[model samples]
Target: MNTLAHGFADGPGPGPWILFVPLMWALVVGGGLFLLRRAGWRGRAPWQQGRAALGEQSPIVVLGRRFAAGEID
Candidate 1:
């Protein structure tokens, strides 16, 4: 019987490819998290920032703009 017919009979066990799967998964998850964070998924989004900036305006300023735009009397 040829020992080579059976894998790892006398040769080295597994190669570095054994760790590639988990490493790829870790990279995929980590990259996704990084993208989410960069896209402001964890904090205020761009639209929210615009709203916050508008909100920061003084009430009188908002009223003046509304009156100028004829939104209110």
Candidate 2:
């Protein structure tokens, strides 16, 4: 019976380098997401910046704008 055929081989199965492939992919995807979010945040118009920073406006403020625009009686 041949030793190689009988499952007596002596060599490294996968080695530590195989782990780097998924790690590199995760870093690349995470970095791309971070850059996209940063770009989107910076791309907002100047007028929109204050509203975004302040979160949702109050209902009274919304009514005031509508009244000022003559959209409300």
Candidate 3:
């Protein structure tokens, strides 16, 4: 008999292996983000990098440069 069919027929499958999905997702995603940032991928690439490179600059930095340039009061 197929063990998977029997298990699901019983209910909820079985052991804690269900938790592996989220764990694996976190490992893949978090590890990728960490590696990207560590390698200075932030604000460097257009597609391969993350949000820090997407031209989403903070207001403070923009304002600072504007003030220095006498563009704003």
Best by lDDT: 1
Give the top-scoring candidate (TM-score): 1
Candidate 3 lDDT at 66 equals: 94
lDDT of 3 by residue, 1-73 (tens): 5454234555655445667778999999999999988977756556545445645375666888899999999
Query: Candidate 2, overall lDDT?
Result: 0.70
TM-score of 2: 0.40
Instruction: Tell me the TM-score of model 3.
Output: 0.41
Q: How many residue pairs clash in each candidate?
A: 0, 0, 0
Lowest-scoring 10 consecutive residues by lDDT in candidate 2? 1-10
Compute each candidate's TM-score over C-alphas. 0.45, 0.40, 0.41
**Per-residue error (Å), model 2, residue 49:** 9.8
Instruction: Write the candidate numbers in order of decreasing TM-score.
Output: 1, 3, 2
**On a 0 to 100 scale, what is the lDDT of residue 23 in model 1?**
99
Candidate 1 local lDDT, 13-55, one digit each (tens) = 4554567679999999999999998886867655555655666
Give the alpha carbon lDDT tens digit for every residue of 1-73 in model 2.
3333333345545455567779999999999989978877676676766765555475668888899999999
